[model samples]
Target: MEKKKNLLLDIDEVFCFPGFLDAINEFLESNYVLDDFSDYYIDEAVIPQERFNEFNKFLDSRNLYENAQILPYAKEVLKELDFIYNIYPCSSCINPFNIIGSGRLFADKYNFLISTIPFIEPEHFIFTNAKYLFKADIQIDDRLSNLNENIETCILFPSYHNKTISNDELIKRGILRAGYDWRTGWLEVANILLDQSQIKDDKIKRYLKK
Candidate 1:
């Protein structure tokens, strides 16, 4: 049997969409969506500088991943990919607001992944803010900065904050752009990693729905 290549998969925006934005909306009582911010950190973008501490306090008191939305096709595609690649779900669990209580996030995120992706081994989970420290055959992540150059295939997953990254920038860095839209980005990713010829048109069409 051929050795399956190592794939470092980011858990947060790449697959599991955290409820930070929802928390922000409820806290501020402002109907802000993902498209409302150019900044990577949504709280930093909308929260007033003066009330930042209060906002952090609000966040610190809640589990953001308690109701995190699992991105469409994340489970299905990842399970497919797992047959060909060893997937390691890497995530940054630090709460910049409450570093002292960051350990709780580790448990929260771990339980989420464990319950959701039973295919992936619990031992394969990696929690750290510094992702560049790891090297693998492929790395998929929402933040361009977190995609390590050492990885053979660095796929930049589409997100609201990273929409500004041009194809030229990605090409310059030898990274692949998953797609412009996050809704169906997984289909684009499936085309990249899976055998394109085998991907049924119907399968692609099902996920393209708005």
Candidate 2:
């Protein structure tokens, strides 16, 4: 048997929508929008000091995560990916300033995953800002910084915030390899990783239950 490839999947923007950026604008009454996200760091990408502080407070809300909605095709595609890849729903719990949330966000994230994608067990879930530190064959994340060169295959997940970035610029920035941009929709990613294993593995429980 071939050793399975470990695929690290980012949770926030990829799995859910209106990500932190919109959440920021919604909670703080800031005018920041997706196009405003130019930097890898939100502080630089959107607002500075005061509003950034407010955003941090919003992250601490359990109700926010609990009420959050899943992105289009997220549940179905993830169920398919779960059948084929060693799916690890990785997320960043620690902030850029090395500040961790008050544990409420962590629980909220956990509960969200379990309730949303119940098939993804708690063991496969990872909460870490240092995603590069984790060993994986392929990684799918929304941030350019999150996709490290060390990962054998890095696929950047696109969202409203990152849609403006051109494929050429992504390659030029050294974030994505050549010929690897503009094809990261969930089903596209599913085909790239699972065409060879479309037949669900017998060991794990199947999603469709046919």
Candidate 3:
């Protein structure tokens, strides 16, 4: 039997829609949605520099994933992908604002993934910001910078921050965009990876080569 490929899958924005934005809204008493900001760091975009520390204080007092909901089709598609790829849920859990207490996130996210996705072994969980270190057959992440070149297939899972990225940029870097809408990104990913025949097709093949 052929060995399953290694898949480095991102947790936040990819597997689960984290509640950071919601938290920001709650803290500021302002209703700001995904489309409100194009920056990956929503707090920086919405909150003033003077209020940054206070925002950090607010984040420190709560579990960021408390309201996080798994992205649509994430579990179903991941379960199917698990049959062909070893799913490693890699996440960057550090709360940069509260670096000293960032360890709290590790446990919070770990428990969340364990309770939500029972199919993946706990040993496969990776919590690190240095994603470039992991050499896998496929790397799916919302952050374009996190998609390392060494990986055979690099999929940029669309998020608010990456919406402005041009197709030319992705094609030049041999990366594929799952789609622009985070609501249906997982389904798009399933289409791209589910069929082996599609991998060798001109579009996928063209991007994978470079």
User: Which is the leading candidate under TM-score?
Assistant: 1
Q: After superposing candidate 2 on the true structure, give the runs of residues whose Cα lies further than 4 Å from its correct spot.
A: 18-23, 28-48, 51-55, 58-62, 96-100, 164-184, 196-210
TM-score of each: 0.92, 0.73, 0.91
lDDT of 1 by residue, 67-184 (tens): 9999888888887788889999999999787799788789889988889999999999999998889899999999998999888899999888899988988999999998988887
Separately for all candidates shown, the number of backbone clashes (residues 3 or more apart, or on different chains) is: 0, 0, 0
True-vs-predicted CA distance for residue 106, candidate 2, Å:
1.0
**On a 0 to 1 TM-score scale, where does candidate 3 land against the true structure?**
0.91
Residue ranges of candidate 1 with Cα displaced over 4 Å: 196-210
Q: Model 3, 130: alpha-carbon shift in Å?
A: 0.9
Which rank order by lDDT, best down to worst? 3, 1, 2
Cα lDDT of model 2 by residue, 1-210, tens digit: 777678898887678752556576676578875445555566555556766676676666534575565765567777767765788999976555426664666777788788888898789999987887888988888877788778777877775456666878767655543123233365555555555446454332232223
Error of 3 at 156 (Å): 0.5
Q: Give me the displacement of residue 76 in model 1, in angstroms.
A: 0.8
lDDT by residue for model 3 (5-109), tens: 999999998999778888889988999888778988888888999999988888887877787988887887787788789999999988877899898899889
Q: What is the lDDT of candidate 1?
A: 0.86
lDDT of 3: 0.86
